[model samples]
Target chain A: MKRVAYPQMGNLGISVKSFLWELGAEPIEPSPISKRTMDLGVQNAPEFACLPLKVNLGNHLESIEKGAEYLLMAGGIGPCRFGYYGEVQREILQDLQKDAEMIVIEPNIFSIYWSFNYLHGGFVSPLRLYRILKFAMKKMKAIDDLERITQYLRPRAKKPQQVNLRYQKYLKLLDQAASEDRIKELKAEGIERLQELNNPEVKDVVHVGIVGEIYQVLEPYVSLNIEEKLGEMGVQVHRELFLSHWVMDHILKRVDRSSYINAATPYLGAMIGGHGQETVGQAVLYAREGLDGVIQLAPFTCMPEIVAESILPVVSEREQIPILSLFFDEHSGEAGVQTRIEAFVDLIKRRSERSVLA
Target chain B: MRGYLGIDVGSVSTNIVFTNEQMEVLDSLYIRTQGRPIDAVQRGMAQMYDKDGDLQILGVGTTGSGRHLIGAMVGADCIKNEITAHAVAASHLNPEVRTVLEIGGQDSKIILLRQGIVVDFAMNTVCAAGTGSFLDQQASRLGIPIEKFGELALQSQNPVRIAGRCSVFAESDMIHKQQMGHNTSDIIAGLCAALVRNYLNNVGKGKNIQEPVTFQGGVAANVGIRQAFEDALKVQVIVPEHYNVMGAIGCALLAREEVHNGEKSSKFKGFEMLDMEFQASSFECDGCPNHCEVINFKQNGKLIARWGARCPRWEVG
Candidate 1:
């Protein structure tokens, strides 16, 4: 079996590991992102590359050090810089003299066939491949659902840490579950456990929507655990970007993108690539839903998000919802991010209180 | 003689203010942090105690970058970010204030307010250009007292143009102009103009800078920068009486609100903390691959707080 490795993006690692395992490849899990990873990434990545690419490079380097022979990554075809991450990272690895093969699964009309054939030998039956993919999809959906439940329960829980603990516990159990029925059971059990943590006394929690680039919104390490921080501050976060949502919309072609595109028509008429259009669309949707505020997170120097950030203020004005745009980079300090979030929460809370009294 | 205490421990200065029930400032202190926030807070407290020992502190509030650390140390009733603190202070001082342009030691911000409520705000991210520290460096490099930097700029007959997009380029531009034998005042005036241009383009970008604008923060003390803002906005800028200590005043106002909002008593640890020793230390936790730097804050050789761990393993209240 060939040793395969992939970068981490929140809980997507579990599904990817399972998929690789099903293909009869030994999946090498890169160590969880740390300070050293960031340092290594910053040293090697191009000076102007976005944070996700740098972090991804660090993951590849770490995995290579662990003797992984194959690196699996998704390819893109858009104006956004993400489309070239695979090629650029491959060159960087080759320059470093690392012995590894880059396998980029590009999204195209025949992506399904090409990816399957490349990842699996002809010996594996098509029925088995279908089963493996379906199981992985189920796991992804289950993880996303649990995450959504955790966000809802976090602010309402008497002890937010308990919800986090249970969420982590269930994630581990779901990762270990072999059967689809067990995964479904574990997800249901996790929701029930999380629901029990709600505090009756806690009410009038602030609601904020998170709309941003997919990597920053999904990966806690890259975005600095913003969802958890907001939740701890008694704000219920509504995140629009999820791994399962992206896969369904972009890969499976099951979810429709017209609603978001139409909503973004006023602010962003065309897709500027990446999740920019979706970000603007979701802010509008969240505003219509009467969410008190919305936060847009993006990596510094990201073209798509920069476009979205510029237009979000107009949406915030027209929709009467406050929006804060935070751009992350290698130098982003925890204290600065914390201060901004605290002030934003305070601003929305005060606005809501005043409206209620009036 | 009862009042609230507010402390703003910033990168450059530690400001302390005492406000009466009516939110009027009774006394204030501005001292250099000198790279030691705890010592600065302690010194400020000692000075405040010596002057107003009989006066009772009803509540204590903290703000600025070092707010959390100082809040924990002083047992603050309320701790708020500098943005909220500045906005609250500006609005309270001038209820009709619509915009606030605050340039502090290390960071600068533009806050838009509507009907005394903060509607929008933007802070400088990943860049420290056009801030007070930059102006300070330039002033010293030109061999002029920072206190007289503004006065010198006003004397310029023709201000030279200096690049203001980045501090590195700005410094090189200043040096080139200086070596060319241009008048020092013209160079100083040009530097002020450049800084203001940078501020408006960077920190105040895309925001409405309506009238009734108030400029506060330590940088407001520079008449040159204030003049540059007036020139750029073509409107009079109001500098509040307590401009430098506005952040402290805001949290003091907030602390009063907090105390009045059904809180029985303040959590103030009192001025006696001035005599006690507080130690903060941190170490990398290798329990996981994340290698989170867990910080331990000790007060008088006893552990009071631990944080910075990604997981809740090391966190303590």
Candidate 2:
């Protein structure tokens, strides 16, 4: 087996690893993200960059350093920024003197031969590949479900330590479930273990709102499992941008405006450019909805989100919504990230205390 | 007489509309968001109060991305998406209208319809070059107020061609044309033409734009842009009288329809919500690889609603 490694999206490393392990292959860990890695990326890439590209660029460089034979990259061909990310990043990586087989998986209609060929080449036996995809989907769902249930329990736990114990127990079981050949057995055990976990209520916990790039928000490995650590500190976590909302906003409503524009109106008009509008809208929503504080995560040199970051201070000032912007590149230190989060939590707590005293 | 109130809160503006039992718009107010939606809403409500003395508000509906927050604040009976609200409003305005063109201060959208069903629509979220902001910037550069932009454009006998591909290109092209001795009226005309051109090339790309069309939002106020659009499409464009606050009007209509049908009591917090102090906060979850960032709500030091979590598994009563 040509065990290739690529820095996939956030939380993807572990999932890919588990998937690889199930395939009877040992997968190498993609190189960690670092400042130097991003610097190399920026040098090789275009001026207009999304956060995911910078992070992935650093990932590809790091993975090459780790002796990976091939780079696994997903391609999006759509109207969005994602469509051009793969090609741009690939050229950047190659220019920077990284030698690795770049496997670009293009997402397109079935008519696209490149997509068909890529899939056919990746898996030798069609039946086996079907089985693998099926298993991967189930495992992904289980892991997502497990994370969802445990995240809530940790915050509400009266005994913060108990929440950590339950969280760890569930995480282990989820990992085990992903690796299990008989997924049914793992599923049953996972559900039973989750139901049996003791959850206590933690009072006066700090609440923090997480908002940023879609991948950065969901992938635990990317954000360093920021949500779990917050729960361990007895902080309540509220994340903006749900998959459901994104789907409704992006997929469904995308066509909802078709009835409004015509020959007379001619142009379909332009978009609000960046998440600036959405961030402003969300910050106000958070303020009105009564969130304690907000943390915005964006990859270093991300244009759209940078616009949002600029306006967030105004949102914070006007709505009295405390918002912190965290820009991450491959070089972001775990300790530094944790310290900032800890301080933010402390700030919210002190603010809460002050509000009560007044 | 039973009535409904609708609130549409967008990034640049806040709109409030009132409708009678039959869902007919009685009055409305369009307030600049001015980066303070809460204050805008209060001011709008105060305006409504002044307009209609002792009109019983039976229900309230809120829409747009900020619908939930505003809905919660106003104790709304129904909270809906902008698409749904726009569709409802457009359908009511002209049942035969098959297409709706909404271009606001920051964003633009084209909604296609086949007999009142929203068959297809496209929204551009990543471009400002084709939006009203571009026009505002150009108006400033010309030392002309936005309100006077259309009038000046109408005076142009000859319109120059400015690059309509992007804001940067259009702006540089405009400055170059100005240096080349193009009259201000012609330049304004060229700017409007560029805006429409950019809109078509970018947002309206690959879409079939049909007729029975309605133009709306703040951008619709610019007659120069409307004429430019007409020149491009070679068709007559109809602008609704209440085009500026159609979203709010739509929500109010929806609310009226809901309440008249004996729906549950409106969730609107009432007029007193304008005075309440609310707090919001968020934290990260490191429990798993899915580092979910969650948000919560507090009113007067009491924890209220919490949202933004993928799994509602953490919510409490």
Candidate 3:
């Protein structure tokens, strides 16, 4: 079996490993992103490339060093720079003289079919392929469901660390589950274990919606574990960009994008590519839902998010919800981000108190 | 007399302030951090203690970049970010303050307040082009005292236009203007204008900067930048009396609030910490691939705190 590897994106490696294994390839799990990975990525990538691309390059380089023969990447078609990430990474890899084949799975049906056939050597029958795909999809959904539950319980829990630990433990168990029924059982058991930590006395938990580029929002390493930080600060975080949500909208074509698009119409009338429209739309939705505040995270020099960032203040004003926009780069420091978040929480809390008095 | 202590350990300066029960600043001190925050904070505390050793400290608060470290060291009753600290100080000084433009050593921020509540705020991200440190560098490069740089700008008849997008480009642009036979005062005035333009365009972007604006921070001492702001915003900018120590004053006020709201006693470790030997060290944890740098803080050969690890394995409370 050919050794296949993919970049790390949050818990995406779990489902991707399952998918690759089902396709009869040896899945090479690249090590989790670390400081060395960032260093290697920054040393090689173009000076102006977005952070995700640099980190992805580092993942690919590390995987190549592990003797992986094939690299799997997703391709896109949009005005956002993400669409060209694959091509740029491929060129960077070739320049480094790395012996690996780049297999890009585009958003089109034909590309998916071709990639699957190539990876599996056309030996896996259609029925078996369908079963494999369904199993992977189920795992993705299971992971996302557990994540949502964790977010819900994090702020309400007596010890938020307990919820975090339980979630991590369950993620490991779910990754090892072979059967669909086992996955379902594990997810239910995990949720029950996490629910036990929730404290009934915890009230008025601050709710903040996170809207941003998909990679930064989904990947903990890239975004600096912002959700966990907020959760520890006694704030419940909500985000629309889950890996399963991406799969549902792009791969399965099941999501109804109209509501978000309509909500974004006033601020961003057209899709400026990437998750920019989705970000604006979700902020509006969160505002309408009376969330305490909104946080927009974007990579420095990101075009789509820049457009969204510029327009978000208007939405913030019209909707009467405070929004904080944070831009991340390779040099982004943890202290600065922490300070901004602390101040933002304080601002919203004071605002809410004034309104109550009024 | 009973008082509250606030300490702001910023990149360029460390400020300590003592406030009375009515939130009035009784005494304040501003000292250079000089790239050593702990030492600077310790020195500032020693000086404040020397002058007001008899004042009973009811509560202790900390703000600025080194707030956590200092807060932990002093056993602060309340710790807050510089934004909230500055906003609180501004609003307390004048209840009608609608906007606050604060430019410190390495960070610049704009906070918008509505009815004494902070409605919106933005801080300079990934850039330090127009902050105090940059201005200090330019002043020294021109062989002029930073204290007199603003006065020189006021003497210019026709200010040249300087690019303010980046510090390197702005410096080069200033040199080019100087080589073209422009007066030093004109170049200084142009630099002030450029810094103000950059501040308004970057940190103050997409926000309604209303009148009753109050500018405070170490940089607020520059009359040239204040005049430039007045010209750009078309409103008289009020610089509070204790502009440089506003953050410390704010945290002192917050400390009072925190103490009054339910805390029976302050957690202050007391002023003797100035003489105690405090040490901080860090090492990379290789337990996982993340290799997080875990920091250990010690005082008098006793472990006080351990943090900075991504995982809780290395964290000590």
- Candidate 1 Cα lDDT to native: 0.90
lDDT of each: 0.90, 0.68, 0.91
Model 3 bad stretches (over 4 Å): B261-263, B315-317
User: Where in model 1 is the C-alpha error above 4 Å?
Assistant: B261-263, B286-290, B310-312, B315-317
TM-score, predicted candidate 2 vs. hidden true structure: 0.61
lDDT score of residue A240 within candidate 2: 46
Alpha-carbon error at A76 in model 3, in Å? Answer: 0.7
Please list the residue runs of candidate 2 whose C-alpha ends up more than 4 Å from where it truly belongs after superposition.
A1-5, A9-44, A47-55, A60-174, A177-184, A187-358, B51-53, B260-263
DockQ of 3: 0.72
Instruction: Write the residue-wise lDDT of candidate 2 on A241-322 in tens digits.
Output: 5543443455335334332222102111333343434555555666767888888877666655666666666666667766
Order of models, best DockQ first: 3, 1, 2
- Predicted candidate 1 versus true structure: per-residue lDDT over B73-150, tens digit per residue: 999999999999999999998899999999999999999998888889999998788899998998888789999999
Candidate 2 lDDT score relative to the true structure: 0.68
**Ignoring the other chain, what TM-score does chain B have in each prediction?**
0.97, 0.93, 0.97
Query: With candidate 1 superimposed using the best TM-score fit, by how many Å does residue A310's alpha carbon deviate from the native?
Result: 1.0
Model 3 whole-model lDDT (C-alpha atoms): 0.91
- Candidate 1: deviation at residue A35, Å? 0.8
> Of the pair 1 and 3, which is ahead by lDDT?
3
Kindly give the stretch of ten consecutive residues in candidate 3 chain A with the minimal lDDT sum.
Answer: A120-129
